[model samples]
Target: MIREFFKHLPASVDPQTRDLAEQQLVGYACTRRPDDFAPLVAHLDSILSPDGDYDEDEDEDGKPKPKKRRDAFFYL
Candidate 1:
């Protein structure tokens, strides 16, 4: 799966790089069917965490609490 592939890749990769890759992939899909990319758009939205207040503390798993989601989605 793409998620697992990403997980196995170097974690040091910049987030912007990941975002660019996603955008390119979505763009590629749009080229195949001009009128039916809505579902793919929704799936992209689901990958992102929700916005607003977040805890700065780390969880028991030592992971930082999820931060408030940003406006990564843009309408053009």
Candidate 2:
């Protein structure tokens, strides 16, 4: 199933992005917890979605906010 998911990624996606997505997918799959799957899918959706920039968080001055480190999750 994970292979199928990676196989279906759009051809237009660059190699680096595709590689990152595949890595994240694999990491998520290793968790084997059903609940973790949704966030993994949501992350992939954000990457593939065309509506807006993937990095949407912003600060008060409208500048892009620094991404917070996910200390609890090694994959992150």
Give, for candidate 1, the lowest lDDT window spanning 10 residues: 1-10
lDDT score of residue 59 within candidate 2? 89
Report the poorest 10 consecutive residues by lDDT, candidate 2: 67-76
Q: What is the lDDT, from 0 to 100, of the residue 7 in candidate 2?
A: 49
- Model 1 per-residue lDDT tens digits across residues 1-76: 2342244334444799677756755575667453355445445434442222344679899999786443333333
Backbone collisions counted per model: 0, 0
Give me the displacement of residue 43 in model 1, in angstroms. Answer: 23
lDDT tens digits, residues 39-61, model 2?
66656855674432234568899
Best by lDDT: 2
Off by over 4 Å in 2: 49-76
List TM-scores for all candidates, in order: 0.31, 0.48
Each candidate: RMSD: 9.1, 10.6
